[model samples]
Target: MDNFLETQLHPAEICVVCTEPFSLSHQPVALPCKHIFGHECIKKWLKSGQGNSSACPTCRYVVVEKRTPRVDFDTSSIWKALCDQPPERLNSLMMAIWPGLKILWQRHPSGNFSITEILDQAVIPALIKTARRTESPQDRSYDPVLDCYNLVAASWDSLGRPDTATGLAIAFVRLARLMSTASATLPKWLTSTARTNRLLWRANASLGIFELDVSWDFIIEATNLEEEQYFPLLHLYTVLVSQSIAHNSQPTPWPTRRHDIMNLVVERCCTKIGGTFWKGKPSNKFKDVLVAVYEELRRYQLEKGKMSLRGHDGEERVVKGIWALAGWTAKKVEVR
Candidate 1:
């Protein structure tokens, strides 16, 4: 069998933090926040007998590792890599994320089980052995996209096992927190910040929680003053949508407030961003997701063609299930 870390992978493919070539041999280990490090590093940390107090150097996330014989390499570069790679590395993250996203779009709520297994058994292990430690933030080290993809991978794992959602959510939130802590300490690595910010937002959104007192500070900081206004409403909408689904497998209350927020998101999607956004994107594009959601909501309200423009049910959610499609159609005429 070939060693996993010595394969002829591209330089861009190397994980900077591990100071090793990217390969498919050794297993890659993941921190709770979805950051991938060599299995060896994690093993060494465990052996250090930090007495379960050994935290991720970057996020300070504590994990109890079963220690054995292994060498310890510093993980200080994890934070810097995250901050530095957001812009140039966005495409890489997108590459890995897109594969997982495809799995969601196709299998979703179902194929998740098989996907998680593949990530754990194949992907994670292959990336572990080649890892090297970085002493400083200047390391152009490992692909941050890979780490981000690891986070998304764990997310796929959570869906198959909703019971794990809280743990994954906690990991993600801590990852964001680590970034904040690192940013305050070293301000230079702040280029492609938005990409990671959105990742954290979506992770929290998936947790089905509308209110997060713990996450509020990070939310305020991750977003600009203008975008910050969308925080509370968006968060609320996310939580309510999840709650509207089921409890004890029973449908909860009608999500009135959630529907209202959904309408707002649709309205925002309607705003033409000089055609920069929502063009050729899927129904789930942030610009158009709300409209898609609203259209679904409308189907429940209007009872098909019986809805009228002036009637309460008719006017309220007339095109809810089809709002996003309608919005797209409407945009064509406006553009013409």
Candidate 2:
């Protein structure tokens, strides 16, 4: 009898919620717990926080479910071709990322480069998307060098380690340069990026020649900082060895053990002079140094002919070329 009464509707009885009798305005409605009350009265009870708001007023039964926490990640902007993008895309990246240059050019009245707009809309978004390659979407950490390095490595490797990813390299250089030391030295960000530069240097490095060949093509068109290498890359070994060896604390001298000394001096140079340098042509003082190392002239190695500049020492030093000059039969060119 009691169970039947709980289920039965008593329209003539006053609503427990509002102490009101059912009428046109006091319409009755049933709850999930099989309790009924005047429509507005029950709604006021549930929403008023007078007691257990989630439960039916009469039966104290929960009406709505408690929602659980969720993980929502969006991956739409990451380019699918990141690991295998073509050179043209890398070229575009080279042009797009350097806002500093755009800022410089925009100083002119006619400059139309929308520096902030382009970065907010295009450049930063693209780099952030690329940076996500190494990130947890939930954590979403932002590291400038690590982020730039990832894009650089992906582009260099995808495009067969081409020298054209200069913009990305320069950006990475700016980020990394200040981290290793307290005071600024040589704008030396490139030294910190050995791992990134090695992607390209690996080609000739294994053949017992360690060189990052710089040519006109590298500097041609718009470049990152128009980033001509500070040390003439072709004669870099000469410059590094010639300068550092005179200190003579090195265990073995040059020629007898070139690689060991070469490694030592290069390390010292990277440690000391640093390579954030991205402006000016290389000084040719090393032309006077003995030919302990050499190569260049794939010079027209791109075309059919090689090119050269008269050295301070009067022997022709490759200003632009491709073939590498080296071997046990190395010949010496005298400087005037």
* Residue runs of model 2 more than 4 Å from their true location after superposition: 1-95, 98-100, 105-171, 174-323, 326-330, 334-336
Which parts of model 1 are misplaced by more than 4 Å?
1-77, 104-115, 121-336
Q: 58-148 in candidate 1: lDDT tens per residue?
A: 5667665334432322222333344455443433332333333334335433322332433443333432322234653232254543453
RMSD of 2: 18.2
- lDDT values, one for every candidate: 0.38, 0.37
lDDT of 2: 0.37
> Candidate 1 at 293: error in angstroms?
13
- Give a tens-digit lDDT track for model 2, residues 1-336: 998888884544678877878888889888977788889887766655434765886677887543334332111112223323443444334333433333433563232323233333344444654343432332334334234545555655576654332434433333222121111221233333332222222211222211222322322221122333422333332333323333324343233554553445445544343333323332222221122232222112224332222122322133322112322223333321
State TM-scores per candidate.
0.25, 0.24
